[model samples]
Target: MDTTSNLEEAVEVLQQLGLKEYEARCFVGLSRLHSGTAKQLSEMTEVPRTRVYDAIRMLEAQGLVEIQHSSPQQFRAVPLEEATETLRDQYDARVERLHDALETVEIVDTDDESSVQQVWAMTGQDAIENRTNDLIREATDEIVLVVGDESLLTEDLIDTLNEVGNGVDLLIGALTETIQDRIRVAVPEATTFISGLEWLHGENATVDETAIGRLLLVDRSTILVSSIMPTTREERAVFGEGFGNGLVVIARRLMAQGLLTVRDPKQ
Candidate 1:
């Protein structure tokens, strides 16, 4: 790229790094010249003479530039490597302070049972996956999962299941042997079972098939039912908690019935 293009790009980058537009332009101008008076910098960078002083003051405060107290007061950009290292150090220190502050902050306390009693609709694949992962990680006793779509079995979900300290029962349906193998390898502690019921009629069933969804019951208290949209292929989910919640009750009963159905065919 040409020198003008390089200067513009550098100014943009510096602005993103917390410098104002005038500061960025002034710094770039000074860096190219090694050192210059405010008037010279204003002319080279096209920054107004009035704003150049303000920008120079900011750069001096940030330790990115040095000022020589002469008749016209010359300004020099700090050595590039030193200026970058200073910015990195300041960034790291701020991040560390923020982390420490957050660690001490108390999260708002709410009654989990009452708070999650209402069914919440979650749209988008990322939202569904994140909510599911949160539910899985919060499970303390057991997790019952009914998987009807292999696409929903993400690596992060598998890792979360593997990390669960309690029991996990997985009922898988309509997945290829390879996908099933991947799940088994990732979540070795889970008791795997093949779901006998075929929610869809044939192998060519599309995502629109009502059967293309998954059920999750966490500690028999929280439940999430999710499906993949046929057209957009985006995932959607309804989740809720509370022992007496209607959705929770229905999910519990359905899971129980599924287990019994898998265990006994004559019934």
Candidate 2:
């Protein structure tokens, strides 16, 4: 006889897989015995014999149980790992098909002339940096950056930039001497520039006329920008990737209007 608590736990597992109470109990009884006739399972699990046959048939249809055409009929549970793997494979296939369909739809919609601004928020320094690094890896043409303060610079970000190869152009707005040293040491081949940061300083705005902000642009399309001071409070950043209101549009404007300065690659 199955213990009451073991029956309860078995019922819970079945329910988690979308089985009703009666069906769960019947399946649990069959699983515990390895293989049993419907009448026998009904007696052990306390399910009515009439309901037990139907539950076994339903479980067999779901590939969770197998049936034998012998006297009184028999049912057996599939091995747990095999059942789990089969369900997982089905779920993965469905997801892959859905993703493919979405990609095809996106290709058609991308042809339409439209502007969109989608905002994404991520908390914690590690998550923010990870998102930024992913954007960098996807950069095929260029990457832009603006820094409000140098304190946010870390070895991980610089290391990712260095390893990204020569396919991307790296641009920067304004950064401190120490931060510049870090970047130079990490990525000696990177092209960097400084301009338009004077807007940040109220009085010294004239001394250093540059923009004070942290904006990362990838592939002239995707952009990642942050406002939080990673040193003071729990920092957050936004990552936006698409055609409209992103690197493609904004970086073009910055380049055409001379709002940005490009560092000489030779130096």
Candidate 3:
């Protein structure tokens, strides 16, 4: 590891790609030279001269190195572009094999899948956004979403909202009129409103208290409510799917705050 930062970094990356420590060092050492002998690779990489030959043989088997059988022996790494492509293909193949191997495992859950109402918790902004978009896509009758923060109006969410089928009713509410206006232009087909939920961003709120993030009610059945935690400002969400479930019912009421009467999900 007592080498140039760039060389050390290259060796670390190669090891992460499934190369052994000595193999990575040898491959990286050879990469810097058009051709190198065992002694030269050992001196450059700090790997034992005796181990260099073994590492070179493994690298050659993996199509990362080419060996010239001279009296002492010579080794050269494959061209950088070709070597990268080979590694990528190898990594992809390994991933595919792992997926295939695990795909056949049977679920061991003893409880019936639908016997009880289930609520799952999720964290992270990207994950919450993806789950919200998925719920929107699955809506057959209605998709009601309330944005508590303007920052959550990402292009991906807008794209997902715009892609909703014409047959589905799409209602989007923003905490402020300006955000509502943006939503209106971004998705003209949807009805946009300025939310009446004052608690989402009350005047007394401070950095120590959690803030409302986003609320999504799809088909009046599936519900996702996320909150931004204090201090770190990390997003977390709880998702539940079931018509007439308590969580779903509460979300429906909350999202339909400004309306005179809440529409029945079944209707």
The numbered model that scores best in lDDT is 3
Query: How close to the true structure is residue 254 of candidate 1, measured as C-alpha lDDT?
Result: 61
Q: Evaluate model 3: give its TM-score.
A: 0.66
Q: Which ten residues in a row have the lowest lDDT in candidate 1?
A: 258-267
Question: How do the residues 84-135 of candidate 2 rate in per-residue lDDT, one tens digit apiece?
Answer: 7765775678789889988888344654544466667777767877887788
Q: Estimate each model's TM-score.
A: 0.53, 0.46, 0.66
Q: Which predicted model would earn the best TM-score?
A: 3
Model 3 poorest ten-residue lDDT run: 258-267
Model 1, runs deviating above 4 Å: 1-117, 166-178, 200-211, 257-267
**Would you list the C-alpha lDDT of every candidate in the order shown?**
0.76, 0.66, 0.87
Off by over 4 Å in 3: 1-102, 112-116, 202-204, 259-267
**Candidate 2: residue 220 lDDT (0-100):** 59
Candidate 1 local lDDT, 1-267, one digit each (tens): 998899899999988777889999999998998789989998998999999999999999999999999989999999999989988887788889999999999989775556645998888878788888888888776677777677778888887777787454444332445655766777777766555445522267765564446788887789888877777777788988888788988877766643545532112
Would you list the rank order by lDDT, best first?
3, 1, 2
Model 2: how far is 101 from its true place, Å? 22
